[model samples]
Target: MIQEIKPAIWQILGKQPGRNVVIIGGTHGNERTGVEVVSKLKSMIESGRLNIIRGTLVLIHGNPRAIEINERGSEPHADLNRSYLVDLLEREPTGIYEDQRAREIAPLLIVSDVVVDLHATNKPSEPFIACADSSGHEQVYQWFPSKKVLSDPNYVLAGKLVTTDEFVDAHGGTGLCYETGQAGDVTRVDEVMRNVINLLIDQNLVEGEVRIPSNECEIYEMIEPIVLTAVGFTFAEGFGNGSWEPFVADQTIGYHGDVPLVATYDGVVVFPKIQELRKEGSPLAYLAKKVNERKKPPRD
Candidate 1:
């Protein structure tokens, strides 16, 4: 049976022609910054506080049921971000809450020209953008405020886990997701909204002056996703998500069944989580290396 159904799609037209951009927030229930900022953007448009100078702007509340409950997904382990694959949409509508929702959005993703799905981390960490270099366009990273961008080749190699951006790209649209600060951070809402506004101005979807930053941005290429199956697994204390400490090859970070898992190269950690029992294939964390040519060549 279909659960919570919230009609949160909003489309506004501009006076002239431009790119069809879709911004999605709250793909994960616990990430309220998207919902809060999207709603605020909608109000600004309705109140004549902002104008779409060109093309069309579409706003979507990605996972309303999950957001309503203030949980990561509608149910345990059912992440909406990882449920946008084409196979799941076509053959697994009844699979789970996330699958069902994916079916509802698969078509919409194709029609939009540019898509930005907003999300926030579970714990307090720095903000960043996660995109695939294969997703198309170098400027996609510039549209956000985060100075750090992650291009995970393994995520593409894993194949099964297709994010909203990848799914959108398969359908011929450019898509990317922005990871804001912690989900519960009070400043998250404003920061996200400001970034969205900047994107609008930068993309020329709205009319305004935007100060594109001259500050340097860094690119991190995800080398591997650390799979956690051991009931008892953890990293060294103080080593956590959003960490960018370099380690010599073979330095121990954690262990599995008495087997020490060491760094394969000089790398940094991302998305460190401590779970008593992690489902198989669950990425406990990711190891990445800073890259200079993030705009050129697919990650190896």
Candidate 2:
């Protein structure tokens, strides 16, 4: 049956007991694809057009306030996606809207068996999935069509970044983040939504035959983040064109002052911050190499 857990959160509890599934959208507020997908699912359930049969399905609107204003975040410098750390969730509420949302969402994630947080990029880029390398994560992500998987098992982003997926993973759940390409693009919505429904069916949370993708995923293990320095930084001419753009050894990713930031091995730059979003003390971009490309390639 359909039930509202909060203003923007809903629960569809199945009669049979099974895994606790949580799906989140609008984590960035401006990423409308996820919001659209989850909202449709909620409406279907509410209208008796869709039904859950095996587990509790939680539909969450990650940041309704930001969505109302159609902005990346509800407040300046307070990203809802980056507010899932344990300390922040445990402490007295800072009264930040995102923080309070994180705290309210924490309990659901802690007991969830699977969590999928949908998102979109600010710049033009290929769609991809981000999650720690694990069998649980593999089971969920394989259902999606995106082949580029960013696996950050080491907490490489200065070990300070705690996102929704990472938070769910900490408590032994399969958490997956699906970036559905550029923020304004709606072309992939139908495809993404189909895969999400397939996942629900495959997990037996909903009744249907499962559809599986045959494409093998290319895994990129995160090496480290390129931190923006106080002197400032700039992307190389061909780099920062998009996420997952490849770079070769010694190729300059950008420059900090007059010093060049060069790659040490063949890899891709992930999540390069656009000029307007660039902030010092935070990652300007992250360097990652394919799982098999960790060893330096043979050169003449």
Candidate 3:
């Protein structure tokens, strides 16, 4: 059963001894993939269809109020994912929903040995993993079984944004942000559940053999985010998420009315969300350059 320690936060503990792992979903209320997966897992466990042989597993719904309204955030221009700023971990009242929620959720990271922060893009795309510079700890992504692991990009980590995955990592735990798929896609729930189950098995939290994917995982580096800061920003071509086409310098991918938002360097346009209306300072898309074909390396 799911117990509510606080509003919007829920945890479930397994029967046996193991590491403490936490997985979060619904950081953006509109992203239903994580939330659905958590709920489904809860049912599966209760019905004896799945078992957690060891370790405690915590599943959290990051933005319950927003999910209640079926919007990205409950209020206009609100973002819950970026609310984990370091200074705000004090748990003091922040006067903002996302900020206050972040404070309430901070304690979970303290006990987490592994953290999986799940997310879904506004535009449809293939699943991927967003990890920090894990040069020394490169084996983390092998568990999640994603072909593409994205690292730093253009203007990556440029602002004061502190994500949930980063916070859990700060506590000396393994943290990863998994982008399941597009928000409204029906298959994202299964994708999120499958990858998370693989993580659990690889970590020995569950008693099962891991199913390795046939395709090799690849790594990419995000170089730039096409920011839609102006009122009239619109895509030149309606690009879906994960649309990686060759882009040249000064090529107009979109426009702020008549003003072209051109690429400054050569790369592929990725995670483009051209179908929705976005607030200023939000990303219209990101450009990524392929770093390499990810390979298993000798352990240090």
Candidate 4:
């Protein structure tokens, strides 16, 4: 049976208890694919087309207020996707829409066995997966078709846990973020939906014949996120537009004012910030190098 847990959160319980799974959409309100995916799942379940067979399935509309206005976030200071930090979740309400929303959603994440936070980039790009290296994380990501995986073992993204998947991982759960290309594109909705359904089946949360897809992936260990400096930063030339761009050792990446930002090693730059999204102290872009193999975290 499916029941509304909150304004934009719903819980579907199976007769046989199992893993607690939370699938979040609209975390960044402008990411339409996730929002649409959750909406479609709700409709499918409500209309008797989909079934939850053995576990609790939670569907969350991550930032309803921002989603209502069709913006990345409702507040200027807080990003819902980055508001899940421990301090923020444990503190008294800050009156910021996204911060307060994170507080409301923390409990669900605390109890989740698996979390799939759907997202999309602001600029055009191919789909990719981001998560820490772990056995649990590996279990889910293999089901997706994305060939590139960013493994952040040292928390270079924000210097600490902030994203939904990161928070989930902190509490000993499998968490992953699926970037479904650009926010405005909906071409992959059906494909993404099918992938999630297949995941549910594999986990025994839904009944079906599970056909696990290829697990081969080009793993990249995240080196660091290049923070926009006070003097401001800019990609050297023809870079930082979007997607992945490769650079050789000692090559000039961009400029921090008049100072040249040079690459330390051969790697690919992913998730380059467009001009509008660039902010002092925020990530302008992130660097990663292809790894020979992934190192899984020790099981608890």
Task: Return the TM-score for each candidate structure.
Answer: 0.87, 0.94, 0.85, 0.94
Model 3 spans with C-alpha error above 4 angstroms: 133-140, 143-145, 153-158, 211-215, 229-231, 238-245, 256-259, 274-277, 297-300
Which candidate leads in lDDT?
4
**Residue-level lDDT tens digits of model 3 in 1-300:** 557778756666667778888888888888888888877877777687777778887878888898899787769767777777665665567698888778878778767888888887776667778866464335456655466777663336435537787766667776778887787665767766877788788777778897655546566778877777665666667443355656778888777778877767776777666444454787766778777774653443
Residue 270 lDDT in candidate 4: 84
lDDT of 2 by residue, 1-300 (tens): 788888788999999999899999899888889988898888888888788999899999999999888888997666898888856655888788898889888889999999999999887788899987665677788788777888887888548658999988888788989999887677877788788888999899989897566656777889999998899888889988688889999988889988999977999988876786778898878999998422122231
RMSD of each: 4.1, 4.2, 3.0, 2.0
lDDT of each: 0.73, 0.84, 0.72, 0.85
Q: Alpha carbon lDDT of residue 284, candidate 2?
A: 78
For candidate 1, the C-alpha RMSD (Å) to the true structure equals 4.1
Q: Which stretches of candidate 4 lie over 4 Å from their true place?
A: 87-89, 293-300
lDDT of 4 by residue, 162-204 (tens): 8999899888788999999998798999998988898898888
lDDT of 3 at 67: 83
Cα misplacement distance, residue 102 of candidate 2 (Å): 0.1
Clashing pairs in 4: none
C-alpha lDDT of candidate 2 relative to the true structure: 0.84
Superior by TM-score: candidate 1 or candidate 3: 1
Candidate 2 similarity to native, TM-score:
0.94
Better of 1 and 2 by TM-score: 2
